[model samples]
Target: MVKLSNTEIRKLDDAARAGWLYYVAGKTQDEIAKKLNISRQSAQRMVALSVSQGLIKVRLDHPIAKCMDLAQKTKKSFWFSIV
Candidate 1:
């Protein structure tokens, strides 16, 4: 992995916080901007940057039985795990 300077680290932290506020806290860009003491456009960019940097992850949780069945079938067909 590449090392980040303090400024870059600070920006990534801000972007991650903005993403959490918008996605997890259900805040709008305007709200995030106000809460973070940044401009709305900057907040938008931060959220986008967070996603682009893979700082935000989305998962779909399926029941174990369904997931297991799907995984088994996929493995049988493909001879490898897709999960």
Candidate 2:
């Protein structure tokens, strides 16, 4: 694998964050630009960079997954449950 320079690393970091904000947080390009203090065009470019570089991933989570996770957490936690 090719090593990234400091500038490249920073760019990738920005792209990853922008991609997450867009995909995960459901932020628009304009919102990302406002939050990052960059132009909307730059925000769109960063999101595209993340996809081109394979920084984003997609997975389907089963609805029961959340219930199972909660069960595990309850098993470990000291808190009392009302249910």
Best by TM-score: 1
Task: Give a tens-digit lDDT track for model 1, residues 7-64.
Answer: 9999999999999999999999999999999999999999999999999987767688
- Candidate 1 lowest-lDDT run of ten: 58-67
Model 2 Cα lDDT, one tens digit per residue, 4-57: 899999999999999999999999999999998999999999999998999987
- Model 2 ranges off by over 4 Å: 59-83
User: C-alpha displacement of 35 in model 1, angstroms?
Assistant: 0.6
Of candidate 2, the 10-residue stretch with the lowest lDDT total is 74-83
Candidate 1, position 44, lDDT:
100
List candidate 1 stretches off by more than 4 Å: 62-83
Clashing pairs in 2: none
Q: After superposition, how far is residue 7 of candidate 2 from its true place, in Å?
A: 0.0
